[model samples]
Target: MIFFLIFCVTSGFSTLLNQDTLDVIYRYVQKTPFKKIFERSGSEASFINEAIPTAYDSRAVYPNCKSLTSVLDQKKCGSCWAFATTGSAADALCINGIANVIPSPQRQICCDNKCLEIPLKQCDYGCNGGVLTAASLYIENNGIVSDECIPYEENSSKPCFTSCSKEGVKMEVYKGLYAKIPSIMKVSENEMKKGIMIGGSIAVAMNVFQSFTLYKGGVYNRTDGDFLGNHAVRLVGWNDTAEVPYWIMINSWGTEWGMNGTCYYLKGKNLGNIESQTVYFSTTPPTYHGRQVSVSFSLIFIFLLVSFTAVLYLLSYVCGRINEGEKKRDLQEKEARTQMLREIGERRYKRGLKNRSSSSVRRRRLSSSENEDEKDTSTRMIDDSEEEEESEKDIEKVGLLS
Candidate 1:
C-alpha cells in the first residue's frame, strides 16, 4: 500500500488528493484590494537600497531564525496574509538580532481589530483574505505576541480572546514595521535577489492553479492549469541554475503537501503575478511584559553538550553491565553442565558395582548347594553299603531301610 502511494505520488496521480486541498485554499482566499492598490511605500526604499547581491538564502544568513526557515500551514483558513506578515516579521526580528519570536498569525488574523477602530478606513478583511502590508501596519502599531499566545485556529469563526496574548505563558511582544514594495519593479532577476539579500522573507501572492497543488519537486513552470485564486506565500530563496530557475517558496499547506510544504516557482517569469505583488516587514526591538526566561543560543548549546555527554556516559555504563551479566551467565551454565555430567558418571559406576555384587552372591549360593547335594548322595550310598553289610547279620532291616 505504501509503495502504491509512493508510485502514485511519483507518477503525479496524487493530484486527486491535492485538488481537495487546493479547493479549500481557493475557497478561503477571498478577494481583496491589496493586489489592486499595492504600491511600494517610502519605508521599503531604504531597505532595498541597503543591500545588493546575486544570490542569497535566509537560512544560510540567519541560522537562528528557525521560525523563519520552518514551514507553516495556514490550514483551511484564508489567513495567508497574517501568516506571511507574521512570518516576515519574525524573520526580520531574527535578522536584526531582536528576538527569535514566531509572532501569532492567529492574533493578526483573529484578534487584530485595531485597524477596525481606526477611522482611516484601513482594515483587514479577516479570514476572507487581507493585505499583508495592511496587516503589517496594524501589527506594527499594536505588537503581536508569539504563536503560542493565541495559537492559530483553523476555524475562522472562533472568537478572538482578550486573554490570548499573555506574557511568560505564551510569549514576549514582537513589534513590527510595515514596508510595501511593488513586486513588478523587482521582477528582474537582480532586483528580486537584491530585495531578498536585504534580510527576512518576502511576502508575496500568486495565482495558485491546479498544477501548483501537485508540485512534488523540480523548478515548477506553468504547463497547464486554470487560475484558481490568489494565495499568499513567503519567498525564502531562489535557484538560478535549475531547469526552470525557480524561487524557493515556503507554502502554508502543511509540510506534508507541496514538496514538504515548500514549492519552487519559475524565477523571472512572474507567473501568476507573483513578482508583481510582494511585501516585506521590519521589526522594532522586543519588549517583555512579564517574567520570562529567554535562553540564549550559547546557553542552549551548552545544555545540549552536557545532555549529550551524560547520555553517552549512561549508555557506556549500561553496555558494560550487560557484558558482565552475559559473562556470568555463561560461566554458570558451564558449571551446571559439568555438575550434571559428574552426577551421571557416579550413578553409572554405582549401578555397575551393585549388579556385580548380586551376581557374585548368586554364584556362591549355587556352588554351596551343589557341594551339599553331592555329600548327601555319598552318605546315602555308604549308609546303603553299611546296611547291606549289617544285613548279613540283620540284612532284612538294612535292605528294608534301603
Candidate 2:
C-alpha cells in the first residue's frame, strides 16, 4: 500500500518533467517581465533586494521579513507560496532564536483548502507559479493543518486545489501560490564578512545550474559555469583567509543544496545590496491562530495524575537499567584503558631494548613503511651493481693474465 502510494506520487510529480511542459514554463519565465523589472532596479530587486530588519527585532522593523531558508523561486510552483508564508514565519522565529527549519512549503501548497484566497485557476502546476505569504497568513490566523489532512502532492501535476478545510479559515481566499522574498545581497568579501559577523538581514547570491542539483562540501568556483539558475542565500559565516576568503551561505533548497549542508560564495562586487536593507515582524499573531489550545482544568488534573505516575515508574526503571549498564561499561572501559597502557609500555620497553642493542642502527633506518621500501629497493640495486663491478674486475684480471 505504501509502495503503491509512493509510486502514484512519483508518477504524478514526473508528469511535470514533460518536455513540452518544461519548454512552455521556460518560455513563460523568459517572456515574464518580472526578471527584466528586477534587473533594472539595482536598488530594489522585484522579488528580493528591498531590505529590512528581521521581524522579532524590537528596535527597528522592516517590511517583508522573509524566511532565511526559503529562497525566492519566483514563479516555479504553488510551493513558492508556502515558501513565502513560511519565510515570514521563519524570520520571526529565527530572529528571536526561537526555532529554525521553516515548515514544508509542500504542506501549505498541497493542503490548504482556502481557494478564494489561493485562486484555483492560476496555480495549476506548470512552469507557472504563485505566492506563499498568503498561505502563511492563513496558518497564523488558523490552527495547524495536518499533512494527514493534506497529503504530499506535486503542484506541477494538477491545478492547485484546496484539499483540506479549517473551521477558522474560509474558501473565499487563501494565500497565493507564491510570495515576494525581500533580499539583501552580499556581493563582496567586505560586505559578506560583515553579514557573517553580524548575522542578520543578509542574503547570499546563488547560481543554480544543472550541477547544483546535488551539492557536496567544499569551496566552488563561480567562474566555472554560466550560473544559469539564480537564487539568494542566507549568510552563515566565513571559513578561510590565507589566500582568498570563503563565505558560508545557507541555501533554501533544503540541506541538500550545497557544501554538504552549506555553500561558500567567493567574493564579487555589488552583485546585490549587502548593506541598506531592513526586515519586519508581526506584533500580534493572526486572530484564528496563535492563541493557546483550549483544554479543561478538570482534564488537566486527571492528565497530570496519570502522567506523573507513569513518569515516576518509567524514571525508576530507566535509572535502575542505566545503573546496571554503567557498571558493566565502566568495567569494560577500565579493561580497555589497561590494555592500552600495557601496549604503550611494551612499545617503550622494546624501544629501550633497541637503543641498548647492537642492531639499533638497522632498526633506526627502517622505522616507517616509506623508509623500508626505499631501503629494500636501494639494497637490491647496490648488490646488483657490486656483482657487476666484481665480474668486470675478474674479467679484466683474467684478460690481463691471458
Candidate 3:
C-alpha cells in the first residue's frame, strides 16, 4: 500500500506536458515600463567588455560548482519563473565566491506576494506566471531560504512557512540584488552573450513551440508549430564556432528531457525571442539570524526520554494492579474450599449420633419381652401344686369314714 501511494504521487508529480496545454498557462509576464535599470560602474563595464572568448560554457569554466551543473524539475506547475530566479541566483553565488547553496523556490512561490498585492503588469502572480525582474526584486527585498530548509513542493496553494520544517536543518536567508540588461527592451544576441560571459548563468523568458518540447538533440530552430506561452529558463553558455552557432540553455523539465535537461537555440537569430529580458543577480553568503531553528534537537531528545520513562512507569503500575487482583482472588478461593470441607464434616457427625439413639430404643424393647415370659412360667407351676394338695386330703377323709 505504501509503495502504491508513492507510485501515485511520483506519477502525479512527473506528468509530461504537451504544447496544447502549455499555451494557456500564462508562464511569463513581460517587463514593466516602470522598473529602473542598474547603471554599471566603469570597472564593471571594463570587466564585461574584456571577455574575448568566442565560445564559453559556465559548466566547463566552474567544473567544481555544483549549482551550474545541477538541473531541477518544475514538476507540472507553472512556476518556471521561480526556478529560473533561484537557479540563476545559486549559480551567481558560486561564481562570485560567496557560498554554494541552492535557494528554495518554494519560499518565493508561497511567501512573496509583491506581484499579487501591487497592481503591476510586470510583477509575478505565483504559479500563474511571473516576471523575472519582479522575482529578482522579491529576492532583494525579502530574502529566500535554502532548499534544505523548505524543499520545493511545486504547489502554489501551500501556505507560507515562517520557519524551516525539516529536522536538523538550520534555516538561513540568502539576500541578493538583481539587474536586467537594457532594462526597458529585449537584449540583442551579442549583448546576451556578454552578460553570460560576465555572470555565471542568467534567467531569460522565451516563446515555446510544440517542436521545442520534442527536442532531442542538435540546434533547435524549428518554428513550425503553434505558439505556446512564454517559458523561463537559464542561459548558461554559447558556441559560435560550430557550423551552426547555437546558445546552450538549462531547462527546469528534469534530466530525462532533452540533452540531460538542456536545449540549444539557433544563435544570431532571435528565434522564439530567445535574447529577450536577461536578468542576473549579485548575492552574498546566507545569514543564520532569522528563525534559525524551529525546535532544538536537545528539546526533542528530552521529550522522547520523558515519554519513554512515562510509558515504562505506566506499564509497571498496571502490572502491579493485576498481580494484587490475582492474589486477592486466590485467598478468597482458599477460604471457600475450607468452609465447604467444614460443612461436610459437621453433617457426618450429626448422622452418626442419630444411629446410636435408634440402637438404644431397640434394646429396651427386648428386655421387657423377656420379663413377661418368666412371669408366665411361675404362675403355671403354682397352679399345679394346689391341685396335688387337694387330692391328698380327699383320700384321708374317705379312710376315716370307713
- Which stretches of model 1 miss by more than 4 angstroms? 1-51, 113-123, 159-161, 165-171, 183-191, 283-402
Better of 1 and 3 by lDDT: 3
Candidate 3 has an lDDT of 0.69
Candidate 2 residue-wise lDDT at 357: 80
Expressed as tens digits, the lDDT of each residue in 5-103 for candidate 1 is 434443452233222222112212212232222222344445566645445678888877877668878877888888887887777777878777776
What is the number of backbone collisions in each predicted candidate, taken in the order shown? Answer: 1, 36, 0
On the 0 to 100 scale, the lDDT of residue 131 in model 2 is 25
Arranged by lDDT with the best first, the candidates are 3, 1, 2
User: What is the C-alpha lDDT profile of model 3 across 1-402, one tens digit per residue?
Assistant: 644644454445324322211111111211332112212244445555575578999989998777788888988888999999888877777787766777788888887665322222455677887877677656655666778899888887877778886888878876654443344345876667766665688888888998988899999987768888999999889998999999899999999889999988888777888776777765321121112211222233345556776798799999999999999999889999998888888888777777777777777777767777767777767766766666667777778889
C-alpha TM-scores of all predictions? 0.54, 0.32, 0.59
Model 2 misplaced stretches (Cα beyond 4 Å): 1-88, 94-101, 107-152, 156-206, 210-215, 232-234, 237-243, 252-257, 268-402
Show model 3 residue runs off by greater than 4 Å: 1-39, 116-120, 283-402
Error of 2 at 334 (Å): 99
Candidate 2 displacement at residue 191 in angstroms: 8.5
